[model samples]
Target: MTTRTIALVFHRLRPNAIALARDVAAWAQQSGCKVVCDESDVDAIAQGGHSHLTASSSFRDADLLVSVGGDGTMLRAVHSLNGTLVPVMGVNVGLLGYLTNVEPEMALGALDQWLRGTEGTSFHYDDRMMLRVSIQNGSTKQSWLALNEVVLEKQQSGHTVRLGVDIDGTHFVTYSADGLIIATPTGSTAYALSARGPVLSPRLNALLMTPVSPHMMFDRSLVLDPREEVIVEVMGQRPVEIAIDGVAVHTLLAGDRVSVLAATERARLLRFNDNRFHQILRSKFGLADR
Candidate 1:
């Protein structure tokens, strides 16, 4: 059999995350598998006393990518993969890890099941939809992949930005609001939820568009088909900020436009169980049985 390559991605600032990575690295090495990590994480891994593992700038070829932090680290790992289909296994070391499927103590056992095959275990792959966002600003054009939601919000405080909405090449409506969110079904439980957007099942292939604090009367969120393309253009003098997965990336001026669509590529998550979405949700929010 060929030696498998496992890539470890972790939260550098979290001691528990680093410790988990070190343990996994040691186990992978002993199991005759190659262990790798992002080149930027080399120093941190070394400080954690696991310098023998390989450092890779890209994880496109990795058989599996292990995320040793919370949902944020898992998102970062997915971003680092850059649309590669490498399956990610998230071990939660942070609080409210909605994206993580396993805890630190059970991480190694989960890896064992994955490596040894799924014949006797409940191992499986959970595919989640993602969004592709493109921006056109005069002569500059850029695009990004978002596992969560894409946000176009006001750059300055106490100012509402004007944005024109279009769907499938047709003008829809214009709104003056604090911001707009274009979220995948997987993201409906994230930032969109806090904004009063309805929760969507992760298995659905749809988009959730919600406007934050809209000054207009039509403040309800819209559930759209994944095949439909939604565009938002800046219509006011004040510049707007574009954020992907909650990180502000660019500033859009008046007349600039952004297009959002379901990505051709999906995020593959490694799973040891099935149909736990509702259970996890209830546990995360401490919902009452009554």
Candidate 2:
């Protein structure tokens, strides 16, 4: 099957990355491929002087999606995809390119590998785990998918929030902390790591739950089985906010509950042969094998 269509999703605020997105589009068109540019990015693509971009581009219809920015941009791209089967290729234009497949200078080469189906030899699909967060306040309910983590933070400033937790319906400890983070294996390296959570290999299918500055002695991070579900209920007088992948999605009232679990869906990331998780991890943290 030929990959005749490619979608380019970029972070609009990054000028240099926007320029690279346009160049990528132009290059795709030159290779007898159709370029799918998100309407929101149309203006950014225009900045790179592309006048022949294909019209009516949809993330659902593209054979592949390229994210041009940092990990955040890749997360945004993942969000836009809405858990579609469309594999995303992340091109790094910012620092600590954990999710991005290639550096800015290597963008074209990465594209070539994708176009040529250079799996194992140069490119492959690295399926990353995803998270689902559902917040219910009385009769109102909403859900959000996260490539990284779901955070519940205290909004009752000057005072710590009370969070009652349960794992698989068993009563866990009530955490008195500023916030809580429930991250997927893919997110283990992110906020969870900073909060002293253990680093799980990306290939492992697990979930990491870490409390943010809890006031109790039971402040250790919890690594749960993939099938286990986490339920956190707000017990404070004020409110707590639910942050999905760093973006505030909902406000949790005193009685509101947040249910987090491994989503039935997974995120597919483009990876080249030389880009294994351990190598990237070492490089990102400036570790020395010597």
Candidate 3:
């Protein structure tokens, strides 16, 4: 296996993550590997006399990025690595590290194994879909890439979000709900799960649409082939909020239409060869072993 330059990416200065970052950095240096850290991490580790870089510079030349945080931090790191095919490995720090596998204490061991090209060689790599969100009349949306779901929510007080769901210009549902969620199978475990949508296996090739607090009784979740194009129009209140992966992209007016679908580009995440999706599910949801 070829040895690649690895960057140790951590969350913004949190006490818990600091220790893990220190350990990972120390190990990287001792192993004669290059360690890349953010501005704050660089400051913290400067006391230990270890050299590091800002998040901006970390990904510029590194082959791989090791993320130290929960799923949120991992997503942040992935977003920062936009357009680059750098593989990311998440180390679970905070709660709900669904995207992350290795814990703090186990991070060093995992890294050692990865460096030796034995830990994650057998792990399956999954390509995730990204959504491109465009507001009818605004600058490019800031949060166009979502690892989980794209949400169209109501922003005005006491008003509902009336949207017409269309697939390839064909009408699907006209919903009066607090918001609507368009998610992918990889995002099935995220907000889509909380909205009572089906948990699609990560390997499935489909998209999920779930209504959030819909006033109409006929509104139900719809599963469509990955090729279908989803369009949502803001129809009710004067202003509606559009959130992509938990970040607000823009507020739309009554006439604005938001279009979402699978992007040609894909986000690549590194996995431990020994990891299994079913095992993660059983452990996370407390399902009994069969």
Best by lDDT: 1
TM-score rank, highest first?
Answer: 1, 2, 3
Tens digits of lDDT, candidate 1, 1-290: 89999999999899888888889998898788998887888777777577678988999999999999998999999998888999999999989988898999999988998998763355888889999999876687799999999999998999999999999999989989999999998899889999999989899999999999999989999999999999999999999999999888999999998999999999999988765788878989999987
Estimate the overall C-alpha local distance difference test score of candidate 1: 0.91
**Against the unseen true structure, what C-alpha lDDT does each candidate score?**
0.91, 0.85, 0.76
Model 1: ten consecutive residues of lowest lDDT: 117-126
Identify the runs in model 2 with alpha carbons over 4 angstroms from their true place. Answer: 1-3, 55-57
Q: Which of the predicted structures, 2 or 3, would earn the higher lDDT when compared with the native?
A: 2
**Model 1, total clashes:** 0
Candidate 3 C-alpha lDDT tens digits along 203-254: 7777899998889987678988888889888776567888877878788888
User: Using Cα atoms with residue i matched to residue i, what is each candidate's TM-score against the true structure?
Assistant: 0.97, 0.95, 0.89
Kindly give the number of clashing pairs for every candidate: 0, 0, 2
Residue 218: error of model 2 in Å?
0.3
Among all windows of 10 consecutive residues in model 3, the one with the lowest summed lDDT is 49-58
